[model samples]
Target: MMSSVINALSVDIEDWFQVGAFESTLDRADWPSFEHRVERNTDAVLAMFDDAGAKGTFFTLAWVAERYPALIRRIVAAGHELASHGYDHQRVFTLSAEAFRADLRKSRRLLEDAGGVAVTGYRAPSFSIDQQTPWAHAVLAEEGYAYSSSVAPVRHDHYGWAGSPRFGWRPVDGSGLLELPVTTARLAGRTLAAGGGGFFRMLPYEFSRWAVRQVNAEGHPAVLYFHPWEIDPGQPRVPNAPLRSKVRHYANLSAMEGKLRRLLRDFRWGRVDALVEGMTA
Candidate 1:
């Protein structure tokens, strides 16, 4: 039987240099010195999505939106949702409640104003909303965000809220916001990332494909994400990073776009706003 579940295909709108992996190596102040490749790369992805007749949410950086307003508008013009990735690409856990709230409010306002859409979604940088930051969900709700795709639910050194739900839910303690975690598949009682970013690049396309299918078979939408840089294998490569960081950022760059195209063709996709339509509160 054809699965009725519609999966989310999302793009994080930040320049290659703005990725959290490179944050220690490059400061926000130095971001201007490095050439940014997000606009051109996102245009390419937008073209591919246009060709596939696909629409997905874009969790965009406020810095990118402030500088490249037209790109965010183009994303909305293409019929995708516009959401916040916070200003400056800072992680939720790194900031205090007041600081996090300020960042969240500012970024949401900027995204909505610049993109000409009601920005209702957020995804913390590096999926860093975890046990350390229980206040993250409350702030998201208080600041008027309707949903967040900010938890990975798997354990990792940098991020991931281990043992969290794989699907969507409002926090028991939080007031209004909902959580749409990144897609994951359980095997032998361990939760493995289903698809997107480094995982998508590192895994065989077949594994990524099967993982999302398994989620859809369970009648839930799979929330998958990627970045504009993932498709740009020709992008300028940064030098002298830690070996692991370099591997995670650059692995299988040439093959990323093709896999994304296949995923688009193989399944049904749409904006996150649509993905939650008729969803229970």
Candidate 2:
């Protein structure tokens, strides 16, 4: 059965080499040396969404936007929401409150200027906001961001708050900012990652389909995210990256587009801003 709910779809607009998995092997200073495939890959994503007649958010990095202003314009021209994914893809927990604020301001400014739209939504790199960054929400509100999708409420090795709210809520007292967590589904008393990522590629498509249905059956929108690099199987590989990172980054790269197309056809998807407005309304 098709879900009556309209889920939120998002693309984390970054290149293959810029992923966290390659952070150890690649340095920020040498980022310019890598082959720039973000434009080509994101164009593929936009084409897919266009074919599906879907409009979603693009959580763009200022680094990418600064280098590829034309790409930012294309995203905006296609009627997708342009949101911030920070300046350089740094995790919130890794930065102090002041540094985080600085990142927020810089990213929001760069993205807004590049896309010519109000950047109000943020998704921390790697879903990095958790209990340790209790002040994050307050800073987001102060910085004029209306909402965030930075928290993944599941137990994971890298980034998950585990016990955070499963849906959108005001994380800070007296603040209107909303934290829209990446979707998770309960199965056999365990919280599993239902949202997109390497997990979506690693796990069977049937499981993801069931998970989205599970969330929709409960009367909430499923927020799914994926990077442009996920569909690029021919991307240059980092030989020095750890085996775990390589597996996570390389597994099912060729299969992502097909899975994503199926998911889009199976469920209704829209921008996160629309989802946030509906939840608040």
Top lDDT model: 2
> Would you list the C-alpha lDDT of every candidate in the order shown?
0.87, 0.92
For residue 72, model 2's alpha carbon misses the true position, in angstroms, by: 0.5
Report the lDDT tens digits of candidate 1 across residue range 18-122: 988888887789888888899999899899999999899999999999989899899999999998888998988889999999998888888888888788888
Q: How far is candidate 2 from the true structure (C-alpha RMSD, Å)?
A: 0.7
List candidate 2 stretches off by more than 4 Å.
none
The ten-residue window of minimal lDDT in model 1 covers 272-281
TM-score of 2: 0.99
Alpha-carbon shift of residue 16 in model 2 (angstroms)? 0.9
Return the clash pairs for model 2, or none.
none
Q: Give lDDT: candidate 2, residue 140.
A: 93
